[model samples]
Target: MELFEMCPVCQRVCDVQTRRMGTFLSVEQLCPHCQFSRLWNSQPIVRSTPAGNLQLSTSVYVNGESFFKLEKVLKAINLQLFEYDTFLRHAKMFIEPAIVSNFKTSQEMMLRRLSEEDKIIPGGDLWADSPGHSERSGSHTTMDLKINNVVDIPLFKSDEVGGSCQMEKEGLERGLALLQEHGCLDDLMALIFDENFVDPAPFKEEILKVTITEDLCAQDERPVKEEVIESFVTQVKTEAF
Candidate 1:
C-alpha cells in the first residue's frame, strides 16, 4: 500500500494498492467520501499503414496537449493545425466506407475468371494465318489474370479521427489567435500542408510535375517541437472539455 499516491485519472490523493497483472503493474484506488475512481494501466498505441505492409509506431497523448507533435508533423506537410483537426475527423468517416468499398471491389474482381484475350504470348512462338487469326494474331491464346493484391490507397491511408466541425472551427480560431499573439503565423505556414510554403517550387508549372520520389514525401516525420508543445499545453490549461 502507498499513501498520498496521486491518481492520474482523477488527480486526487488516495490510499492505493498495487497488484501485478501478468508482467505489468495495475493500480487501484478508492475514495470513499468522493465517489472517485482511479485506475492506471499501461498500453501502447498501434497504427497500420495504408498498404497493410508497414506497422507505424504511434504515440498516444492522453490530453489534447499531447497531440502537438503530431500537429507539427501535419504542419510541416503544409497542413494547418486547424485543417489537421478537420482532416482527422473526416478521416474517421472515410475509414469505414473506404474499407468496405475496397473489399467489395476486390472480391468482385478476384472472383472473376480470366479472359482468353488477356493471356500472355510465348516468346518463341510464331503466329500463323488461320480463320480465327489475323495478320497481327499470336500463335497461341492464353488467359492472363492479373490480380491486384494491394488494397491500400492514399485516401485510405490519410484517414483521421472525427470531431464536430463547429467545435473545430472555434479551436482553430483560438489557435490562430494564440499564434497571432505570439507573432508566429508567418512562419506557421511551414507547419501547414502547403507545399509552396514548406518547399520551394520554381514555378506554378513545376508544382504540377510528379515524380516517384515525391510521392514518398507524403509520410510525416516531424516531431512536435518542444516550444509548440509547451505553448499548446499552456493555452488549454484553463479550458474544460
Candidate 2:
C-alpha cells in the first residue's frame, strides 16, 4: 500500500496511514504541519470554458502623458487593460490599511429609527423595519463605514513616480520582445484599445465621492471571498512562472 499521498493544502507528500479510531481505509492521509484532515475522497468535477471564446470587456483611463506610451507598453507585454484591472483588484486586497486609510475616510454613523409602537408618523412602520430593523423590538446602534478618498491621494507622486515609470518601461520592453517573438504585436494592438483616448479627470473626481457603508448587524471581520484570492494567486503565479 502507498504510505503517503500528496497533501493539497501544503503541496507536500504526507503520511497516508490512518491512526485515528474512526479510520476504516488502509490509507491514512495527514498533513504534518497544519494537521489538516486527509481524506480519501473522489476527485472533484472540474468544468472549464474555452479560454479564447470567453469574451470580456473592460476599460481603464490613462493620463495624457502616459496614454500613447502605455498603449505601446501594453502591446509589448501581451496584456490588455482588463488584465491590468484584474491584477490591480488582486493587488488592492493585500494593500496595507495604513496606506489605504491615508487616502480613505472611516466614517461612523448612528442609525436610529422609530419602533412600531413609536410610529407617530404615517409611514413609520415602513422605515422602522427598513434601515435599522432590530429583531428584539427596540434597539439603536451606530454603524461604521470606510470609503476611499481618491482626491486625497494623487495618482502619481514625485518620489514614487520612478517606480511606475520603470514598470511601464520594463513591461513594454518585455511585451515588445514577446510580441516580436510571437509575431502578434500588430494584430493584438489592433484588437485592443482601438477607441479614442477619453479624458478621465472628470470621471475620476466622481469616483472619489463614492463611499462604503458597513452593515452594523454584520460581524466585525467580513469573510474574504476565496475566488478573489485564488484568481489573484493564479495571476501572480502566471506572471512569476
Q: Judging by lDDT against the true structure, name the best candidate.
A: 1
Clashes of each: 14, 6
Q: What are the TM-scores, per candidate, against the unseen true structure?
A: 0.18, 0.15
Q: What's model 1's lDDT at 229?
A: 88
Give residue 172's lDDT in candidate 1 (0 to 100).
42
Q: Which stretches of candidate 2 lie over 4 Å from their true place?
A: 1-164, 186-241
In model 1, state the lDDT of residue 133. Answer: 18
Per-residue alpha-carbon lDDT of candidate 1 for residues 14-89, written as tens digits (9 for 90 to 100): 6777754222345777765565766764333123122111111112221223445765775688643333453354
Least well predicted 10-residue stretch by lDDT in candidate 1: 51-60
User: Best-fitting candidate, measured by TM-score?
Assistant: 1
Q: Flag clash pairs in model 2.
A: 16-28, 17-28, 18-28, 76-175, 76-176, 77-175
Error of 1 at 95 (Å): 4.0
N/CA/C clash count, model 2: 6
